[model samples]
Target: MALTIAGCTAPPVVAPPEPPSAPNTSADLSGIKSYLLEKTGQLKQATRALKETSDRYYALAKEANFDYTALFATQKDEVIGLIQTAREQWMVASPLYEQMEGIVAGTPSLAEFDMIMDAGASKEEDPQDPAPIDVTLPDGRVLERPGNLFGVTESTLWGTFEAFRVPGQFDFNGDGQIAFGESLPDANVLKGGVDALDEQAGELAEAARAWTPTESDAFTALVVMVPTMSEYFDSWKNSRFVSGEASTQRDFVAISRLADIQDILSSLLVVHDNISPMIRGVDTAQDDAIRRGLRDLKAFVAGVHKQESGGKRFKPEEADVLGKEAQDRADAITGQIAQMAARLGVKIEQ
Candidate 1:
């Protein structure tokens, strides 16, 4: 509407105000913290199981005077049981960790444990994120940041590391033939690594208890952790699950990298879901796009996992192609998210 003022002036038109995008008061991240703590609690249980099994293996070795040949000859059944139990515990604990990685790895205050637990590479590999501790073996050999606790324990249990192997083949599954990673491991190495991992799991849970989750932490997790496709795909390409016998990798063999990637993305999806109301205020269209994008990314990996489960081994080159496609998708989605964060005046940690 226009109005005349003082018999000659006309009032100008006014545009509608832009909608506010204040942080949603309901965007409480205490749920995420609760989920993290719950998972860590379960992880503690699983690692304790590993610790107990490793202790048994250690005690058995000690009983036989640390002689691998004598231990295996007399206590074959016991050794087999301990190895199987340890493997089962690993399967449980690793996924529990993965279920909470979005929170743990995204928060700067707690990212180091991710390296110590799963993501770090070996001393020889000199991984970009190396496990930050040097492990001193019982025999006086120091493993200088020899990798993640999961990897060290897995390699030892599965006989993947030459230094940790028992130097004799045994059909652990009673299949009457030797399979890959079917032999015994060094007792001291297994016990030491598992014990360290168990302790760290407790420490992580303690830190989580002391820490609080903020909108900043949630957003930072999404922005920082969600676009890591190429690195994950490279690992999948080199793993035994994707490369079969040609794979020279060790740790990820116990569980397929594809499975791990899917689990990780699943957790990230939960993180995004929690802050979705805040994102919607900033831009409804973008909020929906990010949501759909996350589902699509997980589905893409799920397709590959289905094929792998059906016994289709992907060549290394093929994995690179798939990885690039996923990377491009992730880049686009995160780009939209980064823009939204800036517009909302939210600070995202790089």
Candidate 2:
């Protein structure tokens, strides 16, 4: 009987039930982490896409001889809209992902959650150019050229429009003010009128040369002429039916003039983007160095643009000063651009 009692089986070993799963707790937290990282990457890609698209649109607008401000404005709105949409989606998804992580780890306080997820939103609208409108003629077809500059001035086409509006008689008859009449005179007479026109054009050109844009309004008007100056080169080059080669004997003149205006515009835009980064504490000493380099480059390009175009008639001694200034600026900017390009892996000709 003792032996039988000893043989009795021991009580079955008890196993505890598995612990309850925490709400949204990932085993390794890798899933949620990966998702947040991917979302951030997507946001950056969207920003890059927006920039590429904008650059293309701007380049095309400039090529078409469109009004720069209006062209820029049109592209800017589209870019801003795209950025807003991407940001909204990123903001919504990012915080939610972080929240899930917090829940899985431990219940985080609201303030702590905000601290982890909050990069406060910034609100500002991008400035841009307005949509372009085509100018239609009597036959409902767009006019390729409006002789005497009537069609250009009639529309919002950019340039020194005031030149077209001056009151003057076509001949010695001393008629009343010559308004921008609807129709051009017959082409047969056009050749005969060249001498008088040449004289008038010379006077107008002298006025353009002498005019110094002193006030903001005058500067704006001058700035607006930049695209037209560039377009003059295009028109001279492309019109095969016209005397293209003879027209561009002074081709460099047009390029130099347009370059000056573009240099100014580039400087203004750069100051807004890169220079401000240095000033705002967004970046530090390296940024300050880059900013100084950019400033020097900008000044040089401005001088080159002015001198090349013969925009300002400088004395020989002044020309040397201007030349040195331009060279210095160009060198500085080229160096800065090279440094930046190396960091970003961008390839551009100096």
Which pairs of residues clash in candidate 2, taking residues 3 or more apart in a chain or in different chains? 70-129, 72-129, 73-128, 73-129, 74-129
lDDT of 1 at 89: 89
lDDT (Cα) of model 1: 0.85
The number of the candidate with the highest lDDT is: 1
* TM-score of candidate 1 to 2 decimals: 0.90
**lDDT, each prediction:** 0.85, 0.32
Clashes of 1: 0
lDDT of 2 by residue, 155-265 (tens): 111111232222222221225453222111211122112222223223333432333322221112212221222233233233221232333221121123224334343
- Estimate the TM-score for candidate 2: 0.26
RMSD (Å) per prediction? 4.5, 24.9
| Inter-residue clash pairs, candidate 1 | none
